[model samples]
Target: MSEDLPALMSYLDGLPEPHIVFDMDYRIVSANTAYLREFAQGQDVRGQTCYEVSHRFQAPCDQAGESCPRARALVSGQRERVLHLHHTPCGEAYVNIELAPLKDRRGRIRYFIEKMESLAHHHGAPGEQGMVGRAPAFRATLEMALRVAPSAASVLLLGESGTGKELMAKAIHEASPRASAPFVVVECASLSETLFESELFGHEKGAFTGATSARVGLAESANGGTLFLDEVGDIPMSMQVKLLRLLETGTFRRVGSSDLRHTDVRVIAATHRPLREMIAQQQFRVDLYHRLSTFPIRLPPLRERREDIPLLADTLLARVAPLRHLSIAPAGQHRLMSHPFSGNIRELRNVMERAALFCDGDVIELSHIEQALAADAWESGAPTALAVPMVSAPVPALPGHRQAQADAALWEAAQAHRGSRAELAASLGMSERSLYRKLKALKR
Candidate 1:
């Protein structure tokens, strides 16, 4: 209201930090330029309080247990700082806020100061620690890995797909005594079945077709650190013999070389398939299996460890936020927990990353979760029709409606039209995509 306040506001507004003053009622008495750009919602935010504009919550700061830094600043006279946080709907964009006591010339407290410093957490890059859950199985496995990481013993990670085996292997390497050494990964399953040995062991120059020059295999590439063998179960039966021999003798020759090369490389192998079963079936060598299984660790599926969903969700949301620059909302958390993530940790990360990429604002919503759920449906496999028990006692149709005599009528109609999939979908006001999905389920 005073002419001097306008001049003072102009001066403070020029600074990069978002700053503002709030009256005793929590109303925004005045704000700076950065504050307008950061929190403004089209209309003026000056007269409104923090709660009214951002949270849309009931009552003022105290009664609401308002835990944010801005709310604390408005209440206390002392200055304080908060870590990464958001006062808006989206949680991705971060800004640290500082509050200071404001006073008039007459020595009376007129308002409080709120200054913001932008930050980037509650969202950041995933280090070697991508395993986010805090389940007992996870903790125990981590402890076991850390214990063995300092030693040079080979490790064999066994778990279903989506359990983050590669992540665990990297964590072990990073925590090991040989952290400075190289950590190389080789996908045993991806190598061509005919050239598995040449891929793992360095080939001599002119060794075979397309061999222009000599090259070091993964074992030689990771001389001192770790060599992660993903999907070890898929290693061809013939190559398994060479691998076993290399592990036992610590020496292996190139595909076409006679000289033996020795190396000290820690091997960490992972597989989703049943190795013991393969051994029994004569598909995998028993000697090779034993050599790789010196120290075995298995990761539990997400469903078996449901309690860690929230923690994993938070970790993933934080991890996903920085990459795509979007935030995950509390409302989307439930849907994430409910969905059966057959793809496991990898699925969770992919879903979250997708949500961040597709979502508009900093805050992720239910729609994002829905998008993630739909995208992963194909990977989860189609549901089996009639396998799901029908609802008991479907007696009659609605009071004034008579589309079908009973709910079963709808099922029959869908089945009858199932023959002409497209025409059936159009007749029933359903999508062709939905019809195909339903038909697949019925077949299953």
Candidate 2:
């Protein structure tokens, strides 16, 4: 049977339904064209572990609480079948999956043949827009988002920076009853206190010094739709009361206008900041926090769900590669998986974008990743020693040698210790003021 595996794969590929073969370890050995077209987007999926390709999981299906046909087939020595809600390229799909154990000459189970028949007519699973992941943490968040999408509840998204809070907010908007209405976004961090009211509630013609004509605020503009407040935690303490009133009453007066106006906008706020801590410190209003947190959803960071790294990298590459005309090599993907990704998905995107630019050929290599990581390290004041090799040769003292060495040392130290200027100065055994002076001189 092992010797005929190739012929068997060819036979399976000719079938109409999706078929796949995997070993006891759940490593996918072969997948039919139907499976590849539907799941892999026609990309090469050979040698990929089933968890990485199908479920985007780190472990076997049984470990992830999904019904494992392979386990059942192995135990009973009979065909096992189950209905599963699979995440496919088209969308979430309900499929009847059948698993039959393939035996060897010694009557030992060497592989399990999986056949999937679409049950979309039986159960329609909602598509998860572009949110990619099958990890429990990610799945939980996605479920919560989908559940709250149909409601009129004011959702508050909480997560670290670069955790795709905006994407989740958009997903909610897309899934909501007000899907046809506007989906406006307001960057709270970029909006100044003086402009916050005008930006949110709008103003009448000549209402203020800069108001030349009638203007509609984001809240009013998003009437019957969603108004996404990005970095909601950054809303000024002085303006928290105003925001609270708007949320509570669905009414607001424009800046310098006495006329009260009403809007039917759904609010979806997101922030990376710790609002509870802010409330304790009196930096943020407690009432506002409570009002905005009616449906708080926390997005998991990339580091917490490392198993989704491969799928995420592939998805990102699919979107970015065509623009740059570059594909990621196996080594590049492995390199990405090893990264800590402190900045989460945003950091990963940055690395991919940089690698795409660095790669001359169609395929991105390990060297491109190394170069991108080194450049990012330099910019962020992170350690570059690992990404970029240091010069092993000794420096010779000559005319202007001391200044040159000092510049090189300062640059290297900056890469090693990415922090405040005071910290960098202290690490270099110099006063903060002196460090500033040296930086200026170096610029000259």
Candidate 3:
């Protein structure tokens, strides 16, 4: 601490933007009110390490590829700036950070002042542009998307259903050179073999019974733009060959015509099914898979990136609040985090929507979430006993003895395999939220 520390702190606290002062050791010495409010959730942050607060890392920033700005400022004896995607109390946001060193009376660098400006507001809301996450898995996927966005290569997005593959494809298009042009989406699963060619390659007048007039298909309509093929795995073998021909030559004639029309369009495809397995099973063409997957990006499921749940929930709530006039209580958020969202973002959105409708007051509580989840369970006819699969042996009927023994066995099993709540819930054939509630009740 220096004699001028008090004055410096006062100046930083008066500034509007979030700012903090850290030592060479990366310990946060002081943080402005704005910084504390945004990052610390208004908790006491004195003496906390910067890595622990910002990244929840045991080591320093440099070890995690986020080189310490203070160290850079100290070496150069000048201010330094870096862009970082950080997980904050508000959500995951891109922040522009400026690091300036403060010197002691002896001219020795004592502390570094860090001023953070949020770039998310200026650019777009987090998760608004189709993707929203800060987890390492999600970050890696986003990095890949950005790296391949500028190129005209065909991108194949692989992920589970409701993992936002279409959104990622759209992101690629929005960042590409042909962003000004149309970005057409075609759902391959909905098109039949007879109509697939006409739907994608247009149809001439009197092409078929339903073809009343000439029509331009999605591929032609997407000229000089991007064409997204959703559920590519569902395209029949006959249709796959036509799609491959179009991708290979960029030329296709409308049905019932031999015009050999040409259209320059970038192709992006997504599928939840394992296309490699399909190829091995002789269901999908290997050559077409190679062409479509020039740049393959696999999205991580929600369970794999559970740390992003808070930000995701916040973003979802923000989008749904205005329409529903309802807000989620902290308890409601906890319930959401505990659940294994099998349908990923889509499931979360549906849950929130249902909760909003069921909520009587402004704040949605645990009961509202429970009712929504129960409704889903009822609709699906999911059994409650499925929550404990480890106890497979059926107990003998001995008055109330069998039921009591089964409960004991389930409790023991839940305690043993508690490493991953999601995996445990899956093994027990129940939602993670149900498992959490059961464990909480057992504790009581």
Models 1 onward score TM values of 0.57, 0.63, 0.65
Residues 1-444 of candidate 1: C-alpha lDDT, one tens digit per residue: 345677878888898777787877788878888777766743578777766665466666446654455456546646765433245434333344567766677755666777765432221222223454445566566657766777888899999898888988997797687789999998888898767888789898899998999988878888888889999998888788888887888799987899999978888999999999998999999888888988999888887776677567667767767555455555456556655677787788888877776565566664455455545433444332111222122122232222222123335445433245554444333466975775566555
lDDT (10s digit) by residue, model 2, range 144-180: 7766877999999999999999988988898789989
- Give the per-residue lDDT of model 3 (tens digit) for 387-413: 323322212232354344334544654
Candidate 2 C-alpha error for residue 284, in Å: 0.9
Candidate 2's TM-score reads 0.63
Residue 68 alpha-carbon offset, candidate 1, angstroms: 34
The candidate 2 region of ten consecutive residues with least summed lDDT is 389-398
Clashes of each: 2, 0, 0
Each model's lDDT comes to 0.67, 0.76, 0.76
lDDT of 1 at 159: 90
Which segments of candidate 1 are over 4 A away from where they belong?
1-129, 321-325, 378-444
Q: What's model 2's overall lDDT?
A: 0.76
Model 2 clash number: 0
